[model samples]
Target: MEGALERSLRVFSGRGVLRTEYWDATIERFHLVSVPPDTAYQIGYTGTEPLWIGAWSSVGGDEITDESTLEPAARPEGNAEFDRIMATRSDRDLATSPGYDGEYDADPDEDRPEPVVTSFANTAAKLCPKAPEVGCNADRLAWIAELPELEWFSDSTVMKLDPGMYASTHTHFENEGPHEEIYWVMAGKARLITEYRDARLRRFDCAFFPTGNPHGIGNVGTETLWIGAWGARGGIEGDFDIANLDVADRPGQIEEYERVMAARKQRGLPLPPNADILDP
Candidate 1:
């Protein structure tokens, strides 16, 4: 599994042309310099740009592999000293500050809820019932996994499609800019169709679609298909190619119409408005 996971990571990371312009610009902009050996270095990030650090070491002109030569490194003790200083400052500030009125019962730090646990089975599934008008071919299902709000992620979902079912090729955007997507095949086989290339997806296999790349999936095996997907910044605004998709079983045109209308209403559009469309 570890080997396969590494291979998948490589496959996704190397999908597109690598760019070093931003990296070069950042190095110049920050006046960055390499740290000298045996020297302590630190950086306080302001979240203005992406930053990553890597370390490497070699012993006797080769990589270290002998466990017998390993020794326990000293852990940083600055945290304890910093905490002590902060505690002393806090105490001095409180002594000279105004007394609290006790209007709030709970401490601000303690007000956060405990970690939430949920499963794919327990999460509500987004249904895609067959609708000819919408160019849907079959009934499909998707579930948004319950997770704490993330800083960079907008979606964490599991989608299912039955044999012979396919979804329309689509691209997702947020705030008028293309957002990235990643999908891992959890069960069954799939044919990932994208504008740039198509690939077969097996259980445990993963793929990533970078900005402006349109993609979709088709269940090409005998069993049901399940895919775990994650998207950056949510990617809710979509541009779909409905003609290429193949949908299957499920009915009720009225229900489909109602669902469409409700979606439009949620977007704060007029009740009897033209179909929502995206510019190419």
Candidate 2:
């Protein structure tokens, strides 16, 4: 992932479109949109695609409209206090456990118990410095920073897969309600393998995962993969994991999953049910 300084530099360099946009509730800091020259100006390459790239501020909900006009904003003065709070919640302590396996050596009809605490809104708020009122983990992922209050919010625990650790077979439960998500790669490389398409994902690459689709991620390289995931809530309860069931064993279920994957591929979106690895 690019450092804070590098990201700031890139924003001012005009390498891409840089603007702040309003999202659900908060104002995103740096939103980059890609622009290209006319077809006649082509030197050698001949491709017409708008490449969108950029980052945003996770704090203060401030938007950077004009990069050229942006002055160096002073850092929060209370360094000691901020350091103390950050030290208490390093990356290791908040790491997520591996996802549940889909193999059913046991009974398939077994019912799992509902968690006493289904929502993390309160917990996340306490941990986050921006919106202390909401309990979502501000430090849940590697790339996101803290943010202040917002009318709407969504969050989830994510794990980046290390290449050469596992195969590409997995399953994610479909939510009963409407929801949408984006999978943004922070570091390394990955390949999203679904019933329909197999696409490569790299640093700064992003893929969208729509509701009701079941898919998984595979590390396509030897390095550790880091990803940032943002999505809306559907209030569903089901585990996302790798399943051993083959298409021959469950043709109907596999067919439905494939349809979703194919649709997303047509629109150049990521596969649903993004990668979830279990820790041994």
Output the worst ten-in-a-row residue range by lDDT, candidate 1.
1-10
Each candidate structure's TM-score, on Cα atoms with residue i matched to residue i, is 0.43, 0.34
Query: Number of clashing pairs, model 2?
Result: 12
Give residue 121's error in model 2 in angstroms.
Answer: 18
lDDT of 2 by residue, 1-280 (tens): 1111111111111122221110111112122211111100000111233333233222112343343233322233233223332232232242111332222232222221111111122222211121111111122222222111211123322344565332223233352224444666666777755556667778777776666555555566768766555543333322331122222233344455456556767878654333333211
* Clashing residue pairs in candidate 1 (N, C-alpha, C atoms within 3 angstroms): 137-247, 137-248, 138-247, 138-248
- Winning model by TM-score: 1
- Candidate 1 per-residue lDDT, tens place, 1-280, comes to 0010000011111112111101111121112122212212222333444343221121212343444233312224333323333333343342211233323332222222121223334567677665544334577776665223333344456677887776544454333223566887867888776533446788768887876555667787878887777655332433432112222221232344345445546766333211122110
What lDDT is obtained when candidate 2 is compared to the true structure?
A: 0.35
Off by over 4 Å in 2: 1-152, 166-176, 234-280
